[model samples]
Target: MTTRTASARYDGMGRTGKGHITTQSGILTDQYYGFNTRFEDEPGTNPEELIAAAHAACFTMALSFALERAGFRDGTLETKAAVKLEQSDGGFTITRSDLVLDASVPGISPDQFAEIAAGAKANCPVSKLLNAEITLEHHLK
Candidate 1:
């Protein structure tokens, strides 16, 4: 079997803790302000944040493709993915993923929006990347 390696890096400057997330090219992030739970930590960006970003971007791109295929014109797409982390008997694991989508496209109703969001959530590459289970609790508000 061939092993593929992907890299993400970070440098820390003691914003409040001892670590910061460095990009793959070696750039440190400002801070990790979570949209869920509002737990502000001075430490490096946690796994959940990275997962959320991946899921959001992936779902947005997939949703865009779906909209285009459905004859919808280009428009802004905003997405949020919340990753819930929990402790298990053996160790920690990702329990659930909740996604919220908002798009500014004409001629698309709430029902259509829901369908598109569901499609994206199921087919997004990031969603497929995880071995853990994911849930698409979407709200098109």
Candidate 2:
């Protein structure tokens, strides 16, 4: 098994607080994020954006491997994930993550492609990690 880590530090409180997030990969080094970034149209990154990126990258890589396993060596899989955060009595909850995929794989039937894509969507690590509802829409070209 492999492990990864990320850290966040917050100073002050609530909407006025400031935060910096850092990841083990160093791709995000003390990146800034807080209420303004998450709830408003402010610059910097939010947890939801990071989650979407992780889901998109993970699902695409999983589909690539699945395609190779199914004898498809050349293809492009592009995915976009949209994560929805909803406010409720319990604060905010991530309600769903919708994946949109654009694929170009020669010599594959739509049915076959859909099957493999569905399998990858169901089995990808990030997909499995998310507790929210997951939906996938694919365009095969």
Best by lDDT: 2
Count clashing residue pairs per candidate: 2, 0
Q: What tens-digit string does per-residue lDDT give for candidate 1 at 11-111?
A: 44333333334454344444433222124544446668778988888888998999899898857888888888887998677877777776787878889
Q: Model 1 clash pairs?
A: 9-22, 10-22
Residue 129 shift from truth in candidate 2, angstroms: 1.0
lDDT by residue (44-122, candidate 2, tens digit) is 9999999999999999999999999999999888899999999999789998999999999999999999999999999
The residue-level lDDT of candidate 1 at 125 comes to 80
- Pairs with backbone N, CA or C atoms under 3 Å apart (clashes), candidate 2: none
Candidate 2 accuracy as TM-score: 0.98
Cα RMSD to the true fold for all candidates: 5.6, 0.7
